[model samples]
Target: MNSSFPRLVEAVTLCFMSLNESCPRTVYTLALRGPLYLLFAVIVILIVIGNLLVICIIIFSQHLHTSTNFLVLSLSVAGLLLGVVVMPFSMVRSLETCWYFGKVFCNFHSTVDIILCNTTVWHLTFISIDRYLAVCHPMEYQKQMTNRLCVAMIMSSWSLSSVFGFTITLLDPEIKRKETFHMNCFGGCFALHTKEIGVQYSIIFYFIPVSIIVTVYSRIFFVAVRQSKLIHSYNYNPKAPLKSKGFKATKTLAVVIGTFLVCWTPFFMCNIIDPIIDHSVPPLLYEVFMWLAYLNTMFNPIIYSFFYRWFRETSKNFWERLLNILI
Candidate 1:
């Protein structure tokens, strides 16, 4: 065995200092700490500000307020919480490899991670269902997706995710002790699941939601295509851009769903497979996939700003106001 392995592990306990008296005599060198912290800082800033902007746009733009936009706002809220609650600390842990935070915090943090990520997935599912109704059953969409219904869906998503997350943490000791010190290094946390738990989480939370999203979007696109054909066949040029805008919204959401599913698959696959292989996976690879999943949250608001008309208009107005204030 290479003698350097232990040092490498020890060195990972970088810049994060805690009051743990029994902490190993391992700290990341000055050279490594700077770049790592810089990287995390940029990521934290991006996710926070971008998602905040998304929330602001959805909330303040009255014209944008609808069942669909509210569902989007709910999803934005989850992404915001994930960024604010999970990302900064996770960045520290991923780099430091030491759980300087105490036992209680370890459990709380891991539970938050599980709950919020799962909630985001559920939010996406709700969004897909909403879009399906809007496009596939346009006449009934408004009645079916009332404000009360949207609120119920959001509440249900969070409630189910919380129950599932807390239950997993309670039943699975591995998750409860996710952040801790390794024998060779300090703060070695593994949120690795058992085979049964892994399978359940991957299938129930990730795979099922993804399938719903894909299926719903397929149906939505079919309706959109049919609508477009009808418009062309009749040469019916409507005065308002509402119908064309609706189709564009469907296209934009399709992009969103596609991007999310693409980013989500690898993480779920790893979650399912890693523990079944008794966690023989490389830490570097695991970290890569986890961060890649993190990027989904980061990308969502950016995607909306690029593709969603309301988001762009609201963001433009927001920036203009800020600039006026500065001036």
Candidate 2:
């Protein structure tokens, strides 16, 4: 009994007490764990509520039913799914440093994570294109950006992301071997990518989309500047309205692109570098970068509230009506 007591005490710190190959848990002090749990829980709640509110606003507000707003709605859905279907599970795994849900679910979780994130990136890229057409080619904007085209863009983003995510996570035999090797312990779940895989993923999901966004936005800026100068030079400029719209586009570009870079660039940089460096990045630092990227979803609705007067007004009306109903 005395000899077995030592093993029992040691087992308390492992993910599975009965299994010799169980992963050890990162047991935090009570003081630290309390705050960490609270923080992640609050973030998950906010992400879900904010994305849902954005969807509601877009659905009920007639003025918000534009092609661009449809794309925004799709983006909100992706955020909502991430918050609902992904973040809670990740929160537990991240905090506990153990995977309770077994190997199959782990792959599913990882695949969904890749798909939703890529979906968000693709949506942002398409939105940038939409803005380019609206600001730089106002006369052709309505004619060129038809509802069919918008639907096509949305469909393509989702389908391509799904294919890529599934192929990498489930279908690739080499990646499967690497992932299994990484999850050597019974209670651990991790996906390990080779250096080549990491670089390919980063290029496809981050660099390509970001490059397109930057190039298109730069063109929009120059065109807007030219239009503003033309309007200022003429006393009676018919294109004054276009110049005003361009200013709005500039504001939108700054907030959207700036926030995206601040949130995601670190994570993607680490994603590529970690594999090249043989996963030298500390786990805590990697987790921090991952959560920071997740914050982009939470911030999307807040951005709308701040930058969109129409959204604010609609939100106000929504609250007032709900209060009246309750009263």
Candidate 3:
């Protein structure tokens, strides 16, 4: 009788365990899969389309071969690479909440990701400084800003980005390790006391670039206002309306600076906050901030199209051809 009673209890417990095991799978399929899968699809589509448009416009337009446009082209290429190569894989991991891509791919992804992101920031900084010089010292700018100098500047930006990014890669092996399940993960690199390295990276990657951007833009704004005043003072034939070229240029610069601030501020804030937060930030919030950072890539082309008449005309022509074909 005692043996029969023990067996009956064991059988009931086994059945309960089996039900519990299946319940989560059922719940996940019903509750989590639909929304997350749809969201991921939408994000991927937006990123691909937005970046593709930027690339196609740059490639097809000969007028876009200017120094500024060259920087923009580099930025678009990097963003496209990031969108296709890194973001999709990241979205996959976020969906699964696991780094399933092993250590090798993980390190490579981190390296490329850092390099591209830093390059974008530095390129913007360079643009800001270039515009400042052009506005504040127009004569010197015309004399000194040769095409060769522009190419050298672009090359220097990428080389510096590579150095900083590769430094992080060298440290990555020490910072992350494969879990027992073979998932690669962040192992508290930011949490521990690595104050000197953190400060150095912060200075190089964030502080200096941002400072240069702000300073240059400030000077550019002042110069623009002064130039506009001088233009207003000049006597013109009553028949000829005065052109507000300086004001218009300043307005465009403002848009560029504003977009840069809006798009990048969230990312820099996230970097600052990550180390301070004891618990992990909600994944959704992290993703929102990340996409906000990436928003710069999409916004840049729009800024160019809006501020530069040439880009607008080129983009319109490209779309018109496509529309005619589709029709």
Model 1 vs. true fold: TM: 0.84
lDDT by residue (13-109, candidate 3, tens digit) is 2112333321111112324646777876676666567667877887877777777667777777777777788777766554444444655787777
- For model 1, name the residue pairs that clash: 97-187, 98-186, 98-187, 99-187, 180-188, 181-187
RMSD of each: 4.9, 5.8, 9.4
Q: Model 3, which residues run further than 4 Å from truth?
A: 1-44, 173-198, 235-243, 276-284, 321-327
Top-TM-score candidate index: 2
**1-327 per-residue lDDT for model 2 (tens digits):** 356432211223878889887877767566666788999999999999999999988898888899999999999999999999999989888887788998888889888998998999999999999999999889999999999999999998899899888977765433333442435677776653557767888899899999999998889888888877776777576555545668677777779988998999999999888877767788778888999999999998999899888889999998888789999
- What is candidate 3's TM-score against the reference? 0.76
Question: Which scores better on TM-score, 2 or 3?
Answer: 2
Error of 3 at 142 (Å): 3.3
Error of 2 at 220 (Å): 1.4
Candidate-wise lDDT, in order: 0.77, 0.84, 0.65
Among all windows of ten consecutive residues in candidate 1, which has the lowest summed lDDT? 176-185
User: What TM-score do all the candidates reach, one by one?
Assistant: 0.84, 0.89, 0.76
